[model samples]
Target: MRDVSTLVSKTDELTYKVPVGLKRVPWIETLLLSSEPSIRSIEDTVKLEKAFHDASLFAVKEGYRRLAALNVPAVRPGDFLAETLRDDRTMAKVKAKLADEAARIKAVEDRKRVQAEKKFAKKGANKQQKKKFQQTPEDDDLKNLKTLEQRKDGGYSGKAPKSKAPKSKAPQSKGGRGPGGPKGGKGTKRSDGGKGGVRKSLFKKTSGGGKSSRGKASGRRFKAFFLA
Candidate 1:
């Protein structure tokens, strides 16, 4: 993704900038080489320098585009062609600094790419080894079957001893005492039996019934009649 984006950016830069810059170069060169008396003046010299600078920038942009097309290491604007414009000291310094930065960035990206590839390779190798280790139980059964057939063809009367799988112990009841404990043996009651040997009710009704005033009076009158 990164490579593709960089290529796109370089392509756009070349498309827009290269043609105009190249056209100005020959025109600028002719003016600089002119024998006209006005060409040597300070004003014309400055204009000529500006023209040369622009043309150099264009050349550098083209170089970057070409490098990208050829799959060469990329160059930034800061690392543009310095030797082309001998009079521009600023471009030279900017180019040097950008070049160093670009180199550092490239080195870091290359290291990251290498590390990612190695990690994927290691993962693939581990998957292959795990697959090799995972032999099906059926393979062992097939070997045993072949051995049995060979024995029968040889007229051997004795049978091979069969290998038995170890039996798993049944899960113990959660509410009952385990194994040889007194409560677990024979007819002994389980832990659910209370200390008094009486079974507790699963639910009990609460007292404090709401007796109405009429019901209370009727009960007292009934008691009084019974006493008489």
Candidate 2:
């Protein structure tokens, strides 16, 4: 009740005596050209020949059933297995059997190949899905650019997405000069010249060979230089 395909599949797993064809030519040719008879000369060649000849004679005297079972044609009772393989009708049968077996084996291999590809494809799809899920989202700037790419004119139209600017802190005051000045005062009085005053020069030639001296004993050196 098995289908033809199923039967053929089973045939691939079956063991059998492989039919010899042109593949046996080299072996037979070597045996024929050898200087001496092989070790099994009598057992293989002579014995098989005697058996086949006797079987032939027996078939002539009694029946064809035994000859039929031998699976050899009566036209030739070969002296050896190789000779039996060389027969034209026998070679044809061998070729047919080999072709059938080859087809079955090829079918099995094709099935394995298809199954392997399906498995590999499934694994690849899973890997791609996982990789897609693990990837991070694009930056807001890049996302905006991509949106521009999708527009009809293929250019950025409206204002680009703005980034938040850092807040400016008020500057600290030095020397109590500006709005950040000390809470207690109208600011310290400068020694060089009070508030808006200016000094004329610090290098007015002194009566002592123009040698420089401190103008006043003020704690502010920068102011004293200008005032002198």
Off by over 4 Å in 1: 1-89, 141-228
lDDT of each: 0.57, 0.54
Tell me how many clashing residue pairs each candidate has: 0, 1
Per-residue C-alpha lDDT of model 2 across residues 1-228, encoded as one tens digit per residue? 759998887888773433586434442232222122224455444344445556555545443444466564555356555654367776576567667767999999999999999999999999999988876666666876678786646565676567799998544322323233454223333555444222222223446675455643243446643443
**For candidate 1, lDDT tens digit of each residue in 1-228?**
369988988898765333464654433222233222233445554456556656656665766665676667864567555544464676666567667767999999999999999999999999999987896889889987888898879865777678898998643433333335445333224476432121121111225664447656566556533432
Number of the top-ranking candidate, with lDDT as the measure: 1
Error of 1 at 170 (Å): 51
List residue ranges in candidate 2 displaced over 4 A. 1-32, 35-92, 137-228
